[model samples]
Each structure stands twice: as structure tokens, then as C-alpha cells.
Target chain A: SAVISQKPSRDICQRGTSLTIQCQVDSQVTMMFWYRQQPGQSLTLIATANQGSEATYESGFVIDKFPISRPNLTFSTLTVSNMSPEDSSIYLCSVDNGAFFGQGTRLTVV
Target chain B: DQQVKQNSPSLSVQEGRISILNCDYTNSMFDYFLWYKKYPAEGPTFLISISSIKDKNEDGRFTVFLNKSAKHLSLHIVPSQPGDSAVYFCAAIGSNYKLTFGKGTLLTVNP
Candidate 1:
């Protein structure tokens, strides 16, 4: 098991602005995934962060909107660009070996 | 296609009673299956899992049963506890490489 930490646990942001969320892991894990969960909804996979390479996004998501960066094995960052109300949701980071989540960053775009 | 599906959105069970959560997948290619539990304001946590080769896996009060032929799986928690009340997620990972998840089933344990 690994201990993952994510910053900006909860934030209220303005529309058209952007906020970058950071994730730090206690141990080096090969896989790091980003997920978004809207209120009363299920979790949707945004992308898979690979160290030193561009993140692999899921079908409905794009890099232009949700830019991701995995600079190293233990750290990654996700920037929600040009936020909107539709973007208001709980953003979580998970690692491999079953789903281990951080506290989660709740973003409320106004 | 909705590869993974948790038909029931919510389930209510009394404390000390048995709680059963069902999950089904449309994709026959799935080789690995797992269950995760989540609480509000927190990320989902790993619970139990059963691989394609195994029909059952158990841990403490939790047990997972897989019926590969029906493309279905279920998580059973004996003697439900207050802490076990949370959103439970069903996930599968086939040779395709990535794990696909179901919407999740909210289990409410009334004390």
C-alpha cells in the first residue's frame, strides 16, 4: 500500500481561470491515474500519468482541457484549464494495487 | 457500450445483517475484478478483489464472488457495520490494460 497526498483539498475558483492540483506519493509507483466525480455521479477516468511522457486521456477527455504532467515517479500535477461550472466536481488521484485515493480536491467553479 | 454496470443505485441494510452488492460487465475480456469503498470527502479505498482464475476471495467480514460465465460479480459483507456504509465501486481490468469502473452502489447500514 502507498500513501498518496493531494493538495488544494477544496477550492472555489472562478470561471475562465485555471487551477493546478498536485499529487505526491510516499513510494514510487508505476501507475498514477486521475479521476473526476461529479456530485451524485460515478467516477470518470480522466487520464493516466506516465513519468516523462504525455498523459493518456480517456475518450471524452482531452489534454487541452485537462492538462497533466508526471515529472517523476512520486509526483504528478493536473491543471484544469479555463474552468467552468460544469467542471465543478471532486478530482481524485489513485495509484495501482487496487484503488488508493488521496483526500481528493473538490473544485467548485463559479 | 457500458462495459461495467451496477444496476442498483442504492441498497439499504440493517446493521448486523448481510449486505450484498451486485455488479455486472458487458465486456467478456475482463480478466481482473475488484471492489472499492469510499466515504464522503475522501478517495475510494481498496476492499477485496477476485481474479479471473478465482471464483471467490475472502477477507475478514468481506467476501467477493465471481461468476465469469455470467459476466457478473458481487461483494458480500457479513454482519454489516456502520463504517461499512459507503459507496462501493466495481472495477474490471482485462488484457486491454486499463481498469474500467462501474458507477458504484451506495450501501446504507442503519444502526
Candidate 2:
């Protein structure tokens, strides 16, 4: 079992601003995943961050809006750029192929 | 297309009773299924999992039943307690290893 620590447990940001969420794993992992859960919606996979490589994003999401960086196996960061009201959602980071998850960062964009 | 479906939005059960939650999937490629429990202001926590080749898996008070032929699955909790009250999510993983989740069902185990 791996433990993940996510920063900024909750944040309220102004529209048009960007917020970066950081995820740190207790153990080194080859791949880490980012997810989003909007109000009253299911958890959606945003992107898969691979160590030493570019992150693979899912459909309906783009890199410019959610840029990811995985500098090492144990750490990664996701930046939500040009935020809007629609971007208000809970963001989470996962490891161990989805078995373990960080507490998640709840972002409210106004 | 919603590959995973949890038809019931919410369920209420008295404490110490049996609480059953159902889930269905449209994608045949999914080979692994998992259930997660989530409290408000927290991430979903892994509860139990079942493989496509298995029909059932049990862990203490929780059991997951898989019916591959019906493309359905369910989670059963015996002697449900108030602490179990939370949003439950059904997730599936295919060859791609990415989890497809269903809209969660809020379970309220009344004391």
C-alpha cells in the first residue's frame, strides 16, 4: 500500500488565475494519476503522469488547461490554468494503479 | 456514453441490517471491479475488489458479488453501522488500466 500526500486541501481562487496542486508519494511509483470530481458528479480521470515522460490526458481534457509535471517517481504536480466557474471541482491524485489515493484538493473557482 | 452505472442515487438502511448496493457496466472489456467509500471533504477510499474471473470476494463485513453474464455487480454489507454512511463509488478497470467510475450512491446507515 502506498501513501499519497496532496497539498492545498481546499482553496478558493479567482477566475482567470491558476492553481497548482502537488502530490507526493511515500514510495516511488512509475505512474501517478490525477482525477477530478465535480459537484454531484463521479470521479473522472484527468491525466496519467509517468515518471520521466509527458502525462497522458483523457478525452475532453487538454494539456494547456491542466498541465502536469512528474519530475521524479515520488512527486508530481498539476496546474489548473485559466480557471472558470466550471472548473470548480475536487482534484485528487492516485497511485498503485488506483488502489490508494490522496485526500484530494477541493478547488472553488469564482 | 456512461460505461458504468449506479442506478440508485441514494439508499437508507437501519443500523445492523443488510445494506446492498448495485452497479452495472456496459463495457465488456472491463476485467476488474472495485468499490470505494467516500466521506465529505475526503477522497474515495478503496473498500474491496473482485476480478472478472471470480464470482465473489469477501472481506470481514463486506462482500462483493460479480455476475459477468449480466454485466452487473453488487456490494453487500452485513450488520451495517452508522460509520458506514458515505458515498459509495463503483469503479472498473480494463486492459488500459484506467478506472471508469459510476456516479456514486449515497448510503445512509441510520442509527
Candidate 3:
């Protein structure tokens, strides 16, 4: 199983501000998944980050609001632009190898 | 609409007993299903997985049963332990490695 490290484990930001969460995998993976878990809700797929291409976003997610970057196999970043109170949630990155997930970044927009 | 659904929000089981968690999916294209356990302030960890080809798959004390016709799947943990208390999530794998998850069921095992 691969280990994932996520930065900014928790953050508090003002409305309209932006925050970028980083995920680093111990081993190179072909596909990295980003998910959001709202308060008392299930995990929702944000996008799939693939190296050397534009990420594929889910139906409710857009590239402009939640831009994703996969510079390489072991690294990816998710940026929450113009965040609002509803954007407060836990963001996680995962790899399919036994579906390992990072500790997660808990963002709170005030 | 949610592709996967877990109707029960929580479940309680006695230690040394069997714990059954259920999940249902509306999508017919899903070919793989997985179970994950999550603790507070942490990401989910994979528990077990079952492909659509098999009806049942077992590992140690954990077993997963899938019903293709019913579009339902269940995870059974025998002789449940206190450490097993956590939020359990069920996921269905779709195209391009996309996973649709159900609202998790929090399982509490009491000794």
C-alpha cells in the first residue's frame, strides 16, 4: 500500500480567499483522486488528477472553482478559489492501491 | 441523486457478535465495490473489496457479499471488536477510476 501525505491539515480562511491543498504520494501512481466530505456527509469526488493532462472533474465540480494540477505521478495540488462558507469541508487525496487516503485537509471558511 | 446509498446512519453491535452493514447502488455500470473504515480527523482506509463477478469474498473475520440483481452489497464482521468502531463507507467504482460513495454508517461495538 502507498502512503499519502497532505499539507495544511487544517485551516481557517476568510470568505472570498483561496487555499491550496497539497498531496504527495510515497510511490508513483497513475491516477490520483480528490474528494470532499462535507459536515455529516459522504465523500464526493471532486476530480481525477492525471499527470500531463487536464484533470477530469465531476458533474458538480468545475475547473475554475476547484482547479487541480498533477505535475507528476507522486504530486498533485487542489486549489479552492473564491471559497465561501459552504466550501468548508475535509479534502482528501487518494490512490487506488488498496485505496489509500491522506490524513486530509480540513478547511473552514468564515 | 446519490448513486450509492447507506440508509442506516449508525449501528450498534455487541462484542463477539456479527455486525452487518448494508449498501445499495442505483448505477448498473458499477463493476467493483469496496468498503472503507474511517476514524475522526483522518482519511478512510480500505477494509475489503468485492468484484461484481463473485457473490461473496471473505478475508479473516471480514466478509463482503454482493447481489447483482438487487444492486446491493453488505459487509459482515464476525466477532466484532471494540476497535471495529468507526464509520464504514461503501463505494462503487465507475469509469476512469471514479468512485461513488454512500453516506457512511457509524458502527459501534460494545464490550
Candidate 4:
């Protein structure tokens, strides 16, 4: 089991503003995944962040909107750029191939 | 297309009774099935997982049963407690190693 620490447990941002969420893992991992859960929806994969390389985003997401940074195996950050009311959701980071997850960052755009 | 599916949006059960949550998948390439529990304003927590090779996996109060032919799985919790009330998510990992999750089931274990 892996332990992950995510920052900014909850945040309210103005539309068009940006918020960066950080994730720290207890151990080094080759891959870190970012996910989003919108209201009344299932969790959706946003991107896969690997150290020293570009993140691979899923079909419905893009880097310009949700940029990711994996500085090292133990740390990664996700930035929600130019937020909108529709972007209000819970963002989470996970390691150990989805076996463990951080407490998640809840973003509310208004 | 929704690869994974949880038909029941919510379930209500009495405390100390058994709680069963069901899940199904359309993709046969999934290598592992997992269950996660989440509370309001919190991230989903990994509760248990079962490999595709096995039919059953048990850990303390939780048990997961898989049926490969049907592409279905279920999580059983014995002596359900009020504390267990939460949204339960069913997720599957395919060859890509990324998880495809189902729309969670809200379980309410009333006292």
C-alpha cells in the first residue's frame, strides 16, 4: 500500500483563475495518475504523469486545461487553468497502479 | 461507451446485515477488479481487489467474488455497520494498467 498526500483539501476559485494541486507520495513510483470526478459522475482519468516526460492525457482532457508536472517519482502537481463552473470537481492523484490515492482536492469554481 | 457498469445507484441495508454491491464490465481485457469506498468531500479509498485469475478474494469483513464468463463481480460486507455508509466504486484495470471506474453505488447502512 502506498501513502499519498494531496494539498489544498478544498478550494474555491473565481472563473478564469487557476489552482494548482500537489501530490506527494511516500515512496517512489514510476507513474502518477490524475483523475477528476464531476458532480453525479464517475471518476475519469485526466492524465498520466511520468517523470522527465510529457504527460499523456485522456480523450476528453487536454494539457492546456489541466497541465501536469511530475518533477520526481515522489511528487507531482496538477494545475487547472482558466477554470469554469463546469470544471468544479474533485481532483485526485493516485499511485501503485490505482491501489492507493490521496485525500483529493475539491475545487469549486464560481 | 461505459466499459464498467454499476446498475444500482444506491442501496439501503440494516446494520449488522449483509451488504452486497454488484458490478459489471463490457471489456474482457481487464486484468484486475477492485472496490473503493468514498465519503463526502473525501477521495475514494481502496478497500479490496481481486485478480482475474482468481474467483474470490477475502479480507476480514470484505469479500469480492468474480465471474469471468459473465464479466461481473460483487463485493460482500458482512455485519454491515453504519460507519460503512458511503459511495462504493467498482473499478477495473485493463492491459494499459489504467483503471476504468463505474458510477458508484451509494450504500446506506442504517442503524
Candidate 5:
């Protein structure tokens, strides 16, 4: 098991603005992932944050909209750019050792 | 289309009874499956996992059974306790080491 922490556990953001959520893990993990879960919906993969390289965005997501940064093995950040009401959801970061998730950041667009 | 499905939105069971949560997957490439339990204001916790190579795996009160032919798997918590109540999520591991998670089922264990 891994201990993960996220910044700004819950946030109310104005539309058209961007928000960046940070994820820190207790130990270095090889693979880190980002996921989004809308209200009452299943989790969807956003991207795989790679250390020293570009993140791999999933089918419905693109780097321009959700740019990711992984400076090292233990930390990553996800920025949701130009947000809208439809982007209101819970964004989570996970370390894949098997798999473990961070306490999600709940984002609401107003 | 959803590759992993937990059709039951919620379930209720009495304490000391067995709580069974079911999941089905549409992808045959899934070689590993896992169950996670989540409480409000917290991240999902790892519960149990089963490989497609095996049929059943048990640890203490929690057991996971896999039926590869049916693309189905189930988690069984025997003698369910009130503390065991939470949202259970089922996930399948695909070729890229990516996981596909189900919608999750809220389980309530009543005393």
C-alpha cells in the first residue's frame, strides 16, 4: 500500500480559469496515472504521467487541456486548463504498484 | 462501451451475512482483476485481487472468485461487519497495464 496526498481537496473554481492539482507519494513509483470521475459516473483514465518524459493522454483527453508534469518519481501535477461547467468532477492521481489512489481533488466549476 | 461493469448501484446486507458484489467485463485481454473499497473523503483502498489464471483467492474474511469464461468475477465478504460498508469498485487490467474501473456499488452492512 502507498500513502498519497492531494492538494486542494475540494475547490470551487470559476469557469474559464485553470486549476492545478498536485499529487505526492510516500515513495518512488514507476508508473503514475490520472483519472477523472464525474458525479455518479465511472472512472476514466486521463493520462499516464511519465518521469522525464511527456505523459500519455487517453483517447478522450489531450495534453493541451490537461497538461501533466512529473519532475521526479514521487510527485506529479495535473493542470486542467480553461475549465468549464462540464469539467466539474473528481480528479484522482494514482501510483501503479498494482494500483493505489490519492485522496481525490473534487473540482466544481461555477 | 464500458469494458468493466458493476450493474448494481447499491446493495444492503445484514451483519454476519455474506455480501456478494458482482462484476463483469467485456474484454478478454484482461488478465488481472482487483477490488477496491472507498469511504467518503478518502481514496479507494485495495481490498483483494485475482489473476485470470486462478479461479479463487481468499484472505481472511474476503474472497475473490473469477470466472473467465463468463467474463465475471465476484467478491465475497463473509460474516459482514458494519465497518465493511463502503463503495466497492471492480477493475480489470489490460495489455497496456491500464485499468478499467466499474461504476462501483455502494454496500451497506446493517446490524
Candidate 6:
């Protein structure tokens, strides 16, 4: 069981702007991931944050749109670029030690 | 095509009864399955997990039964309580280390 701290518990952002969500783990984890849960939908993988390297984005998601930074093993950040109403969702960061999730950032692009 | 599926949108169960939640997966490559419980304004918490090698795994009041032939799994909670009311999500992990999640089912335990 890993303790993950995610920032910006809830935020209301304007359209066309970007919001960065940070995830910090209590210990070093080999694999970290970002997820999105839209209203009335399931959690979708956004990307895998790699240590000392670029993040891996899933299909329908681009690095430019959701640029990720994984500076070290215990910390990572996800930026939702050019937001819109459709981007309104709960963004979560997870550490894959049999899977543990952060509290998640609830973002509403108005 | 969604790999994991939880068809029931919501369920209402009386307290002290059994609460069963079902999940199905289309991908055979998934070797591990997990259940997560989520309350409003909180992150999804890891509830229980089962490996494909076993048919059933039990943890206190919660038990997860897996049927590989049917590609389905179910979670059973005995003596449901008001605190059990929350959305439950089914997630599967394959060799790739990516977890695919199903649409969650909200459970309402009526007192």
C-alpha cells in the first residue's frame, strides 16, 4: 500500500487554459500512471510516467495535449493542455504496486 | 471495444444481506484482477485482488470469485453495512502493466 499525494483536489479552469496535476508517492515506484474518469464513465489510462524519460501516452491522447513530466521515481505531473468542457473529469495518478491511486484531482473546464 | 465490463449501473441491497458485484473481461491476457472501492470526493481504494491461477480469494467479509472459462468474476460482501455504500470498480492488469478498468457500479446499502 503506497501513499500518493495529489494536488489541486478540485479546480475550475477556463477553456483553452492548461492545468497541471502533481502526484507524489511516499516511496520509489517503478511504474506510475495517470488516468481520467469522465462523468458517468470508467477510468481511462492517460499515460505511463517513466523515470528519467518521456511518458507514454495512450491512444486518443497526445503528449502535446497531456504533457507529462517524471523527474524522479517519487514525483510526476500531468498537464492537461488546451482544456475544454469535454476535459471536465477526475484526473488520477496511480503507482503500480498491485495498483494504488492518489486522491485524484477533480478538474472542471468551464 | 471495452476490455472490462460492468453492466449494472447501480445496485440497492438491504443491510445485513449479501451484496454481489459482477465484472467481465474480454481479454484473456489479463492475469490479475482487482476490485476498487470509491467514495465521493475520494480516490478509488484497493479493495481486493485475485490472480488468474486461483478461482476464489477471500478477505474477511469480501470474497472474489473468478471463472476463467466464462471470463467473468464477482465480488461478494457479506453482512452489508451502510458504510459499504460506494461505487466499486473492476480493473484488470496484463503483461504490459497497464490496467484497464470497467465502468463502476454504485452500491447503495439501505439501512
Task: Using lDDT, give the best candidate's number.
Answer: 2
lDDT of 1: 0.91
Model with the higher DockQ, candidate 2 or 3: 2
* Chain A TM-score of candidate 4 vs. true chain A: 0.98
**What are the per-residue Cα lDDT tens digits for candidate 2 across A39-99?**
8888999999998889999999999999999999999999999999999999999998789
Q: For residues B11-70, what per-residue lDDT tens digits would candidate 5 score against the true structure? A: 999999999999999999999999999998787888999999999999999999999999
TM per candidate: 0.94, 0.98, 0.95, 0.95, 0.97, 0.97
Lowest summed lDDT across 10 adjacent residues in model 5 chain A is found at A94-103
TM-score of chain B of each: 0.98, 0.99, 0.98, 0.99, 0.99, 0.99
DockQ of each: 0.64, 0.79, 0.69, 0.76, 0.71, 0.69
- Model 2, B7-106: lDDT tens digits are 9999999999999999999999999999999998777899999999999999999999999999999999998999999999999999998899999999
Interface RMSD of 4: 1.0
> What value of lDDT does candidate 6 attain over all alpha carbons?
0.94
lDDT of 1 by residue, A1-110 (tens): 78999998999999999999999999998879999988767778899998988899999999999999998999999999999999999999989844688889999999
Q: Which stretches of candidate 3 lie over 4 Å from their true place?
A: none
What is the per-residue lDDT of model 6 for residues B1-111, given as tens digits with 9 covering 90 to 100? 999999999999999999999999999999999999999988899999999999999999999999999999999999899999999999999998678899999999999
DockQ top scorer: 2
In terms of docking quality, how is candidate 1 classified? medium
- The per-model lDDT (C-alpha) reads 0.91, 0.96, 0.94, 0.95, 0.93, 0.94
lDDT of 3 by residue, A13-108 (tens): 999999999999999999999999999888998998899999989888999999999999999999999999999999999997337999999999
Candidate 1 chain A, run of 10 with poorest lDDT: A94-103
Give each prediction's root-mean-square deviation over alpha carbons. Answer: 1.4, 0.8, 1.4, 1.2, 1.0, 1.1
Indicate the worst ten consecutive residues by lDDT in candidate 5 chain B: B91-100
CA deviation > 4 Å runs, candidate 2: none
Angstrom error at residue B13, model 5: 0.6
Q: Which stretches of candidate 4 lie over 4 Å from their true place?
A: none
